[model samples]
Target: MHTLKVDSVQLAFNDRKILQDVYLHCNQGEVIGLLGRNGSGKSSLLKIIFGTLTPSYKYVGIDDEFIHYGYLNNRIAYLSQDSYLPRGIKISDLAAMLIDQLYWDDFANLDIYKNHHHKKPEQLSGGELRQLEMLMILCSKADFILLDEPFTHVTPVETQYFKTIIKSISKTKGIIITDHQYYNVLDISDRVILLTDGCTKHLKNVDDLVTYNYLSGIK
Candidate 1:
């Protein structure tokens, strides 16, 4: 099984320390839910793991080898909070670039792709584009995926649908997902981590969220 381990992460912006100490581990077939309040550095942590953002110090690796940049060689795929598709790129071309051969038919045959493959990113509505981007990231061929606020701007039905997709895809890829929609994160995650005060806390159950005050109480 593939393993991704990270620890000893330290990040700060000017005088404020965002993350001081953290440890996270994931292997194939696991989905780890990351929860934090606003400005808690959940997005920064994902960017650090993906190598898009430089942290003061960090240790990210796959197996035992150090991974300086997780995005190199498609070792990991990242879906940031912001839109990633460029207007100059065609939808079909982006698909050819990111989708694995084994899943091409499944991806190409999706109604969303069929409806938008011929149009530019600018042509789709904000919500439509977000849906397309989310689908593409979840379907891309990568050993691991880091998703930041994936459910944002998505409809309730789409949120539920994507939750199923995430769980299904986790059988082959290790995934770390974070979003303000805490309930959705909890619903699909195999295990959960709450980031607070520059620390990582592993929760034993729903009650732990309460302990951290991340949630008022169990739903």
Candidate 2:
């Protein structure tokens, strides 16, 4: 199985520290749920892994090879919190550039794409645009994906469908996801990780979320 590893990550802004002594690993066919309190640097960690943000110290690798920048490798993908599609681009053209050939049929068949293929991104509703951005990343050729707040601003039905897609995609790619909707993250993750005080806490179960003060109680 392919593996994505991030270790020895350290980040700080001026005197304020964000991440230090962090380590995380995900294997193909597994989903890692990342849970943390606000200002815990969850997005920073994902950015570091994606090579968009440079930490003070880090060692990232996929399988046996070390990577200095994630985008350079092309085997990793990231979904950010905000919409990223450019203007003046048709949904169909965007798909042609981003979606993998192997998953083209499945990508083209999604209601979000099928209905809006002829429209530009700006024409769609906010939620609809979010759905399309996510699908493009999820259906890419990358073997490892880092998703930040993926479940935000979507309908309950869309959230559940995204979970299904994530689970199904995990059969072939490793996924690391963080969302304020902790339960949604928990629902799909094969393994859960808590980011606290700039370190990674590998949780044994949902109860650990409460213990770490990420949640008051687990129902």
Candidate 3:
């Protein structure tokens, strides 16, 4: 089966080690929820796997073949917390470029885009823009996607909508997602893992999150 794997990931800034001996793997048709406390290197790890950040050391591979440039390989997509789309482009134009034409209607039907198809990213509210950005990434041709803080600015209703979209797309894509909203992550994940002390810990249950101090307690 196709898989994206990152092993022996080591990164540091000056004397501070951000990540070390970290490992993670995700296969096609699976959603892996990544949870961590603030400063636990979750975002940095995603950046390293996506090839946007040059770590001190890392081994990223797809199906046992080491990939030198993850982003340029056409097999990986990343949705950063910050806006990555061009502000001047119309929503329809951007959607056409990233998604298949057959899926255009499905994207257009989304509440976030239905009324703003002709508007530019700059004209949308923060929540609207964020939702649009996520939809574009999810609809991309890549087989593996990394999403950072996807639920940050959206309402609870919108967050649930995004989760449904994610589940639908994950039927053919491997997704690695991280957000401060841990419950949402847990809700959508096929499996969940925690990053702590520069290592990855496979979680067996929500209680494990509390054990690792990633959560105050199970809800």
Candidate 4:
């Protein structure tokens, strides 16, 4: 099975350390949920693994082979919190560029695509645009995907739908997803880890979230 591993990820801003000695790994057919509070360096760690943000130190590898330009590699894809699609581009055209032709029919059949296939980014609402962006990334050629705050600005139904898509695609791809929506992350992840106090902690159960201050209580 294909595996992506990131370890010894150390980052700092000026004199303040953000991520220190963080480690995470995910193999194909697995969705690893990442939980962290605001400013816990979750996004920074992802950027470091994706090679978009230079950390003080890090070791990133796939299948035991070290890679430098992670983002440039076709084997990995990173979907940032902000919208990645360019304005004025039709959804159909964007699909042509990112998604394989074999999956074109599947992509076209999605509810969002069926309604917005010919429309530009500006023509769709924020949630609609987010759904389209996610579908494109999930269906891309990348074998590994890093999703940052994918549930943001999306409705509960949309969030659940995205979870289903993530689970389905993960049969062939390794996914590492992080969001403030902890319950959703918990429900979908094959395994969950928390980034707390600049380290990674394996979560045993829902109560672990509370122990790590990720959640107040089960409620």
- lDDT of all the models against the reference? 0.91, 0.91, 0.89, 0.89
TM-score of each: 0.98, 0.97, 0.94, 0.95
Number of backbone collisions per candidate, in order? 0, 0, 0, 0
Q: Report the lDDT tens digits of candidate 4 across residue range 91-149.
A: 88988899966567888888889899899988999888888898899999888999999
**Which portions of model 2 show Cα errors greater than 4 Å?**
none
TM-score, candidate number 4: 0.95
Q: Per-residue alpha-carbon lDDT of model 3 for 1-219, expressed as tens digits?
A: 589999999898897888997888999999999998889999999999889899888999999999877788468999998999897889888887787565677877887778888899899988888888899899887889999999989999888989999999999899999999888999999999999998999999889888888778776
Total backbone clashes of model 2?
A: 0
User: C-alpha displacement of 15 in model 1, angstroms?
Assistant: 2.1
Candidates sorted by TM-score, descending order? 1, 2, 4, 3
Report the CA-based lDDT of candidate 2 relative to the real structure. 0.91
Ten contiguous residues minimizing lDDT sum, candidate 2: 67-76
Which residue pairs of candidate 1 clash? none
Task: For candidate 1, give the lDDT.
Answer: 0.91
Task: Please list the residue runs of candidate 1 whose C-alpha ends up more than 4 Å from where it truly belongs after superposition.
Answer: none
Tens-digit lDDT string for candidate 1 (1-219): 899999999998997999998999999899999999999999999999999999989999999789999999989999998889988888998888888887788889988999999888988988888888888887888899999999888999999988998898899899999999999999999999999999999999989998999888785
